[model samples]
Structure formats: structure tokens, C-alpha cells
Target: MTWGRARCALLAIPIRPNIRGRAVMAYDDNNRGLLLALKYGDKMEGVSTMARWMARAGRDILTDTHIIVPVPLHRWRLLSRRYNQSAVLANRLAELTGRLAIPDLMVRVRAT
Candidate 1:
């Protein structure tokens, strides 16, 4: 899952040396619609299903994962949407995978 590959599902970030690794589930057209609906339609239940799939995709890395941190959304976007999709997924992943999830590791400085 090295970054050298054109499209690796797992992101092996060099800067974050403490964390073991990061992985992504399928990102094809099938998932795109479901993700978009979960992000914009306030479909909270999707979090569970997504986490299950994410957990399956990332099961191997879970053992080494101490915590899960999702990419942040802009403040304005968060305010309007009332939630961050990534955070939702992370939290659910935390619950299902027994790993801690930190929703906000950093700030965007300003709205987009």
C-alpha cells in the first residue's frame, strides 16, 4: 500500500510516523452515491454500514491502530452540514473496531 503506486487504497503517510497505517475502502461509482447520500442527506445509519465495510477493508491494520483520525471539513461546511462525514465514519469505526477516533486533529484556519 505504498504511495508509489498510482492508486493504493491504503495511504502510508511518512510524516505521521507514530500511526501504523491508513486504508480506504472501495471508491468506485457504487460507493460514491452511498457516500454522497450519507454526507449530504443526513443519513446517519449509513455510518454503521460504512464502518463495517471500512472495518472489513482495513481489518488487517486495525490491530496496530491506536486511534483513528479523519480528514477535516471546512468550518463553514461543518456548520452548514451539521456533521463531518469523515468524522462520522471514524467514530463508527472506532466503536466497531475498538480503536480511538479523534475527530479533530487540526483546524483549517478558515472556511473554504
Candidate 2:
């Protein structure tokens, strides 16, 4: 799968229990700005683009997906940030893919 000119890969870490994973974009110079802006600058306008990229990159996995869940933030972090970027992306992705988004499906027990 691919998004723009960036190549997508199915990431597998033998030590991890998960069977597969896919990154929407590489954390390189080309994508760093947009990622940082979305995560820290409240640049929500880019969420649609990012979610679309994710859908394209993970199309195979999504074919079998039943629900979309965002990695939750710790309570303190949630308070400080006032929003979870992952949740934003998850919601947008749900909209694009016609899937259910359970933004609160998981919770961070403590700060990491």
C-alpha cells in the first residue's frame, strides 16, 4: 500500500503480540511538520488528510477490521492536551471507512 510518494510497510515485531501494523507515513522531514502540527498545534484541518492516508496504507488490515480504537491518553495528559489526537484520527477514519469508532475503548492507567 502507499500514500502520496511515501511507501507503506506492514510492520511486524516478533517480540510483540500483535500480528500486524502499518504506519501511515514515515516520521521523516517530509511528514514531521504535518504530524507535529496535528498533534501539538491543534491543526485539526489536517485530520481528514491523515485519516485518508491511514485508510490507504492499511487497506488490507481494515478489510477485516470491525472497529477503530484510538490509543488513549493518561487522564493527566488528556486534561493538559484537552484532546486526543489519536481519537481525532480514529473518528475521521471511521467516517471515511464506515466503521465504528470507540474512542474510549481503552484507557491509560498511568502516565508513561
Candidate 3:
């Protein structure tokens, strides 16, 4: 199934692309850099790639969205991890798209 369909179980819908083609969804793929970053830290290239995607995707998604809300992180996890990938992505996205990044709209109570 598509990412949109996959998210339905949680009552979440993928943000459809606006006039431009963009959607807000999780980055489920584990690129080499991301895997490294997970094991190491932001020193990996994942940050740059993730940042680029966010900016590009944000522009497309914001074409129809007045606001962008990222998948959230728990406070403890946020602190422990020292970073929220989705939030970082959203922040870069908001800057590139000129859209508001509402990071607090969604909260993650747990992870599966």
C-alpha cells in the first residue's frame, strides 16, 4: 500500500500535494547516513539530505497547506535523542516553503 494508506490505521492521512506536488509523511527509509546518524550523531550526512528533502517537500506541501505539522516526539525521547528528526525536517521545510511550522500540533506518546 501507499504511505497514505499505511497511515490510515492511526486515523492519519498523508498530506496531499497541493497545486505543487508535496506531502508530509514519515521518512521510513533508513539510508546509510541515517543509520549512521542513529548510531553516531548529527555528524553524518543524513542531516543535510533530510534538510534538503524538507525544504523541497515543504515548498510543495505548503502550496496547499497554510501550516505544516510534523510527526512529534515525546519530551523524554526528544531530550535523550537530543534531536527530533521530523521537527528539524519541518523547520527547514517551513523556511523553504514560507509556511508556518506548527510542531506542537501533534504529540507522540509512544513509538512502535
Give per-model TM-scores: 0.72, 0.81, 0.56
Error of 1 at 9 (Å): 29
For 2-78, candidate 2 gives per-residue lDDT tens digits of 22333323443222223366997789999899999888888888999989999999999889887888899999988
Residue 26, model 1: Cα distance from true site in angstroms: 4.1
Q: Can you list the residue pairs that collide in candidate 3?
A: none
lDDT string for model 3 (1-112, tens) is 4434444335576544323445434456646556557434755445556656656655545556777777787888788778777676667667766778878876788763
Superposition error at 69 for model 2 (Å): 0.7
Candidate 1: residue 84 lDDT (0-100): 91
The predicted structure with the larger lDDT, 2 or 3, is 2
Model 3 compared with the native: what TM-score?
0.56
Worst 10 residues of 3 by lDDT: 16-25
Error of 2 at 25 (Å): 1.1
RMSD of 1: 7.6
